[model samples]
Target: MSISTDHTQLQRQLYLLGYSHALPSDGVVLVSTLLKDLQASLDRVKELEASTVRLEREERTTRLGHDKAKGELHALRTENNSLRAEVLGHSREADRLRRESRADQYRLSKVADDLRMANLQLKAESAELSRSLGDCQRRCEARLSELDPRGKIPRMTVNRPFDVSRLQTHKTQVQPAIVDLVDLSSRRISALEHEIEHLEDKLSTSGVELKAAQMEVKERDLELMRMNSEYERMNPAQDVGDSQVPRLTDQVDYLHERAEALEKEAKDQREQFAKEKEDLHRRWVAAENDRVAAGDASWWRQAV
Candidate 1:
């Protein structure tokens, strides 16, 4: 019994020592698995740090782009302001030019009206001058008629002196002859003085008439010039009355030629009638001779 109890105690002691040794080996394996897990977590933290740095750089780039867009917008606004100021200045200049043009047009119209009035006054003066010239010409003609010598003077006649001398020898005839000679000489001197006065009056009248005629001619020339100018302004194709003048002249010439031809035909007809009458008279004479010969033969047979 004492030896069996000692063997059982030795077996319990060996079993307890084996269990302690197995517990220590399990603890070492658990520590090795924990170190491998810690190494994997450190690698993941390094990757996260690199991603944060990239995100910060992208945000700085976006801020620079925004500043550049603002600068360009400010430049465009300044250019638009300069263009608007130039347009306003041009509008003011255009309005000033329009006002000046209207004033010039009004002045030109006034000048034209003044010129028309002046022309009318000149025409009235010219017509008055023409009438005065016509009156002067008529007075001159009356004076010229009085001055002509052929109608005013008379001729003188003389008688023979032999009979007067014979009567003088017979007494009182001598005294009468002397008285008649003195009276004839006095009458001749008075007639000469009257003729000289008449001639002077006629010459003065003729000079006045000539001056009036010259003035009339000048006025007519001016009127013709004015008519010519008006005709040119109107753009006339031909002169007044010119076209019909030639036609009237042609008609006159035709009438003259036709009358000459008719006169020649009448003269020829008269000549032909005279020739026919002469031929009929010769035939009548021959027939009368034949009748007389037949009557003579019968008379002769009765006498035999």
Candidate 2:
């Protein structure tokens, strides 16, 4: 725009100097020089504009790549969160199972103690009953021997009376009572044994379940590790440039800032070019006016 104004001012000066009717060779040369400089400046502007367009395209592409990376990172984060939550749940379940297993162990130990005490009590009672039965058998035999008519066995010197009625009464009543006591002890022992066996089976089953839960938790941990590895591999920035995602993000921002700086530099260059072109236009017009005032100095010298 300044070039055109300068050109108009130059034309008006030529008209005022009475040189418009016959433009001197100096005027023609100056106009041609200005046109050439204008063309060159326009070419430089076109090149700068093309460079800006190219830079813009690259910026867009980089931005898209950054956005895609962010999306993938977000997805990985979401997957990681989900896996972490699942792992936490598994851990909680394992803890609960472990607590239950410990409780079962305590109960099993208590039951075993109870069984031991019962066995000891039963043994004591059995021994006591055996001694009582032996004493009753000996007494009955002595009483029967005394009742025999044969005088082969000599009686004791003590004049104590032999209670035949008591002996007969005890013989019939004590045998059945002892037999029933043994039977009842046997039944109680069997029942206690059965209960212990049942509890042991339950403990075994609990151990199996605990083992299974532990194995499952280990598998989940391995799976989560594998997923983390996969996610790391999928991260393009981490694999290629930086080891960290934040560093990659910062690099992208730097690129964008660099692109903006280039654009700003191009604009400044354009402004500088426009200023230089305006200065040149003003200098050209002054030179032409000076030559005309000097009565076309080059032409006069040529004529000489």
Candidate 3:
């Protein structure tokens, strides 16, 4: 500002001096000195112009940096939006999994009830069959005792059990009625076993799906934690308030707990089913042993 004011003043003084008719005694010397001072002022003006240009260039560089920062901020906002969408998608998936888990639990409960009823029904049937088998064995044993009271080999091997030779063979007759009952009992047992196996397969499949769903929930929870970390890392933008983080954290924690509960329930159901199966199997073995103890297969042992 002082330089501009001095230039203006010099211009006005030079015009006045040129216009005046009365010149000073040392006018030549004064004019020469004034010319040199004007020359120095011109050089200073050139330096100031160069400095202005350099300052303008620095301003442009600063503006460029500002633009880059804005672009990066935009990119961060876009990524944050995408992450939020993913979080919503994961929440929906968790809801779907919860529905499916509940359905599976209901199915398992129903199947367990059906299996219990079936076991009870079959247990009664098994008991009846055991009684019948035991009665048949006892009658056969009585006849055998009448023929060979001391369990010794008879003179006529034709009537003996386990005499496979053509000359000494006895045709062991299984009554058609008894055979039919045995076949029916075998078919019933097989059917029950097949049904139980199928139910178990279904349970296993449900469990696998449930586990996979839980893993997905866990992954989403981890992703949510990572997102929270990202938010902390990016701390500049306050567009998204602090409320979302805690709300989302609560959702993830709830999902985690729910998944664990489902898995535990499934495990418990499986254990109960296994125990029921074991009890049914024990009962069946006991019935078979009773039949055998009543002499169902004793004739062959006596022959041996």
Candidate 4:
């Protein structure tokens, strides 16, 4: 038979045994002995039933707990999968940002290099213009010295006869060359100034871009930090569930031990009861034999 069926049969037998021991007896000692045996048997049966009930309750509770644990595990796994995907996405974004930042840095470095080259070119041009101006001034001084041998041209200007035609020709030729040299120098300076301004503007723009890049990096860092904080909050490695497993395991073990202990106690009580019942049965048999022997003696006397 199945275990449940056997248990049911045992329960029925125990009930029948209890009822049989409760039968009315004529002798007080017999009634008392039967009552005691019935009570003891009932007590043992009650203990066994109680153990069965407790074990059943524990088994039901364990099943419920196992189902709950499985549900929680499934939920955690789903959450872990989502978090892993988020982490991967964040990692990819971080990598992309790093690459962009590197590219920006390279561009900014190139702009700086261009600015440096422009400054160097401006310096060289300015130096060349200065040298040209000095050379032109020296040449003008040499021509003036050659034109006035005694260096008395200014002193004799008021006393000499006025040669307007010769003076006009000299003025026309010399003034144009000097004006041309000054114009050329001015144009060179203007071009250098324009180039310097352009370089300055580029440098300023580069600085702004760098600042923006830095700000972007900071924002990304903050975003990553927020994501990390969220991840930590959502996905705790240790929680109430972690402790609950061991606690539930301990409870199950305790229940098992209690059931085993109850079974052992029931077995010992049954053994003790069996010994007492055997002794009582032996005494009852001896009493019946003695009553029969006495009746037989009495009948024999009557017959004689």
Using TM-score as the measure, the top candidate is 2
* lDDT, each prediction: 0.46, 0.58, 0.57, 0.54
- Ranking of predictions according to lDDT: 2, 3, 4, 1
Flag regions of model 1 displaced more than 4 Å: 1-60, 132-304
State the lDDT at 165 in candidate 4. 27
Judged by lDDT against the true structure, how good is candidate 3?
A: 0.57
Worst lDDT 10-window in candidate 1: 154-163
Identify the superior model by lDDT, candidate 2 or candidate 4: 2
lDDT of 3 by residue, 1-304 (tens): 8655555555557676684444344464565577789889999999999999999998898767656654554454445444544544444454445544544555555455545545564455445554454555677777888887888433332233221122122234334453245356556556655655665665566566556655665665565556555554444467346626554665576567657656865776677678767866876887678667657556774686
- Model 3 stretches with alpha carbons more than 4 Å out: 1-23, 26-37, 129-304
Tens-digit per-residue lDDT, 1-304, candidate 2: 8656666666766687575664454465586577678779999999999999999999898777666766665565455445544544444454445444544554555455445545554555455555555666677668877798575354334245332223434433333344345456557657766765665666566666656655665665466455545545655554544435553554465456556655765675576568657856875786578558557665775696
Q: Can you rank all candidates by TM-score, best first?
A: 2, 3, 4, 1
- Candidate 4 Cα misplacement greater than 4 A, ranges: 1-46, 145-304
**Candidate 2 segments exceeding 4 Å error:** 1-22, 149-304
TM-score of 2: 0.45
Which candidate leads in lDDT?
Answer: 2
lDDT of 1 by residue, 1-304 (tens): 7544443443444355463332233344353354456567777777777777877787677556544543443343334333333333333333334333333433344344444444443444334444444444555555655687456333222233233334333332334444344345445435544554554455455445545554554454355445434433443357435533443554465456546555754675565456546644654665477457646865785685
Per-candidate RMSD, Å? 46.3, 44.8, 12.5, 49.3
Candidate 1 colliding pairs: none
User: All candidates' TM-scores?
Assistant: 0.30, 0.45, 0.38, 0.35
Q: Give candidate 2's whole-model lDDT.
A: 0.58
Indicate whether candidate 1 or candidate 2 has the larger TM-score: 2
